[model samples]
Target: MLKHLKEKKDVGFFTSIAGLMNSCSVLDLDAFERTQKAEGLGVGSEGTAGEKNMHDADFTCALFRFLQLLCEGHNLEFQNYLRTQAGNTTTVNVVISTVDYLLRLQESIMDFYWHYSSKEVIDQPGKDNFCRAITVAKQVFNTLTEFIQGPCSLNQQALAHSRLWDAVGGFLFLFAHMQDKLSKNSSQLDLLKELLQLQQEMVIMMLSMLEGNVMNGTIGKQMVDTLVESASNVELILRFFDMFLKLKELTSSSSFQEIDSKNSGWITPKDFQKAMEQQKIYNPDEITFLMSCCEPNMDDLIDYREFTERFHNPAKDIGFNLAVLLTNLSEHMPNDPRLQRFLETASSVLNYFEQFLGRIEIMGEQKEIFADFHSK
Candidate 1:
């Protein structure tokens, strides 16, 4: 049954189903707001205000779960087909509209956080509302992650067409705002964790687009510029930087472990090169540069542990130093989470600046702008 679904002829069938799903999933924001007011805030004395269901959580989740199954697989054939279908039948709108709705709903949930204080006990209805929001958001992000893991070219083109760059910016803003709100309460770890996961997934998706040849030209530069500017918020910048470092560490360690079959903490330079190459993260020159940073022993083996530690340590990173200098963040010690966030934000800002410089083909006006900033 799954095999037949992957066939070219069946693409139209799935595309039509997606289109219908999208049309039916259109959210009535006003009605949604009213429902939240009645159920979450107890705005009206009687329950008559939310008698009509504005959003069907069960139905929506079930529908998306069905689509999620079709998109999930070891291969991307069916997902690609559904995504590439022409005209109104394409699945891109379905994904984008769902994302738009989910982000807005989550924003409302964040607003709901203001109603109760950490010192005060949350009422039954408030508790239920918060739980409901988390469930729906998890479903949306889980389904969307599957939907996005497909051919980069098709996904990148759809990204531009759907104006996802704008959505990405909006999401970053919402994330930062939510983080600020949650920091006050500090009890909603579940929702905060989910947001963190979503942030990482969104960044990974954008990295996929940038890593692919699809976004390597002018449009790519523009998109990168937009993202860099959008991530200017300090909270968002720290989150992105922390996620980036964690991801890099995970991938690099996995690669290193694969090459160190003997479970030793050391490997030859040739093995190091092979492992790095397999990750597809670093270019040849970058790999060579990393290799140069390591001091091989007389046996000519690299200390993988020491090398990784040195790579992750931000003490000497220019961005980290600049951040410390600019923010005067001497109150917290090195291991403090507050100080860590400062370092992460600084590192990400530096990386974004470097990326902006490297991505532009012609120096032109952009170079002068960057140079002016540097000179200042």
Candidate 2:
């Protein structure tokens, strides 16, 4: 079956399904706020009210999107079947339990401390939201997990069905990266252990689902509806995971914190102030990473190899030679008052930048790159 599935079409379709649902989860402005009303997981969302609410809606809505693709539609038809079910206690249990496991992973990142920044958003809007959302989402996930493990009599058969099996497996892979996050002062060994156990259970569950389909009487509309319901929830599970690992830098190492401007990897707050001083305008890539919060990864922005290659290329560096031409302006501008005023302004900026860079060297071990919350 894997071989028969065309890489382009199958991966494309499923991944597109994943992407769209991801958007939906974070799209709704209101539904996301509802999560905050829940207990045990609401902190650090202080000033980000609007941004956080909108972000939550976009993320959860995407989860619902994934659910619809599996079950057919997201409207009354599919939801009704899921809400009905005389004995669906079992199936709901499975979904909730899976979510609980995922929550632990999300919490690890959300609750993590020791975060640093050159800009308010790591200098990246998307990455910042991903970090905050994962924390709240993880708590909700764990709530569902306990729902299943505790008093609920989960529909062992429904959860063990074919489609639900695969959906669950996919989420396991997505959230599994949490093990590699930077987790000092945070005791996450238990979370990591539980995640590995869940991975094993996911495999077992998938087999059970396939076997059930072979022996079952008729799969029925309820079974189909449940498949969609479970799949959608699985997306939520994955979102918490992806947001934690990719954006938040949840790994155990602070390697990203040490990126050097000379190497063009990380941008510190000091990096920003230096640029603001306009010191010889950074290597263009460095400037882009600094201003835009990394077109690539927020945590690790500059790629020295790419920076050096581009800097050395005459075609590319032509854009960077603005300073050199400006130097000529500086040389000839004293002859004319109008041009001289412009020159004065330009030179002031240039001088400030040069001084800023010198200060960084002068103040070694004396001050932090980012003030207030940061300490060297």
Candidate 3:
């Protein structure tokens, strides 16, 4: 929309937006502050990146173009303006700073992605903004990739370019989260299609970037360690979600209540075994699996009530602990090739769990049909 800016004021306006878009976008300041105090570190550890501000799409779009054109056509003027008027002394160079800002914007997009996707119900505006963020992320990454391989001296700006690790790590976690969401069958067809497409784009782009030489000599121990820890958290949290779904279905049956005949809210191991034998809903091996889900007391009683209560609200559990971990560890992790392989393993296992659940559901339906036919 803002094609040409002849006035110095116009240049300043776009610059100000760029800075605003680069500042930290804390969705919950109190929660963030709590985490910072708990961890003894600032939110910068999680890559304090601003979410792409799309309140006025037209204005943001025009600002993006203006900044790009400034870097391309008016490179000298932009650098000169920064030299004299830019308050931020950290602007190393036009290309490096722009790339850094754009990369942080992508980071902001990830922040928004996690926030909305983790919600129980996303409003229409949230969905629209998420889609917009996805589009902006693709553009930003592509531009940054081009800029990295462009005429700029990547070696000189290696520290700034190292932020790509954060960007890549964010997408890896996103890839896992999107896959988990798809398994739940929550989204409508259109949104589902979009998520699937986004996954594909993420895979292709990330794989290409990781395999490329652009990151050569830039990997650091701190970054890789951070990513590894983040991946471990992702694997654990995803497993919790899977466990909650399966346990919820199991506890919904009358078997648990039947076993706790006295309404004591707890059942002994022997009583549980007896109930399973009478119900015949599960085989010996399956019963063993169910027993593993139980929490045992010192008296060897299975705390059915307590166990169910622990995961009664999977979303709430996730929101409190896993969500914070994902948000804090969200920034830079998983750039190492070995970690990528580990993610692939984690993904395959998650898919296998989904398939296993689907089979169980189908078998339950068949059992119900057989019972109805027998009664008829």
Q: Count of backbone clashes for each model?
A: 0, 30, 1
Report how far off residue 65 is in candidate 2 (Å). 20
Give me the candidate number with maximum lDDT.
Answer: 1
- Which ranges of candidate 3 are over 4 A from the true structure? 1-53, 58-121, 150-162, 192-216, 219-229, 232-376
Error of 1 at 223 (Å): 4.0
lDDT of 3 by residue, 45-155 (tens): 442222223544444445445544544532434434432334443333333454465456556556656666766554454455556566555554443333332222332
Candidate 2 per-residue lDDT, tens place, 1-376, comes to 2223322224443444334433433222243344344322664444543364444544553454344343332232333333232332222222433333343333333322213212222223323444444443443333232222211223333333424433343444344334333121123433433443443344333222222122122322323333344544433332322222222221112443343524444454444434334443334543343334222336644343332232123211221122232333333232434434433434533432232222111111223121111011
Cα error, residue 5 of model 2, in Å, equals 45
Q: Can you rank all candidates by lDDT, best first?
A: 1, 3, 2
The 10 consecutive residues of candidate 3 with the worst lDDT sum are 367-376
lDDT scores of the candidates, listed in order: 0.50, 0.33, 0.45
Candidate achieving higher lDDT, 1 or 2:
1
Predictions ranked by TM-score, top down? Answer: 1, 3, 2
TM-score to native of every candidate shown: 0.49, 0.24, 0.40
Relative to the true structure, candidate 1 has a C-alpha RMSD (angstroms) of: 16.6
lDDT assessment of candidate 3: 0.45
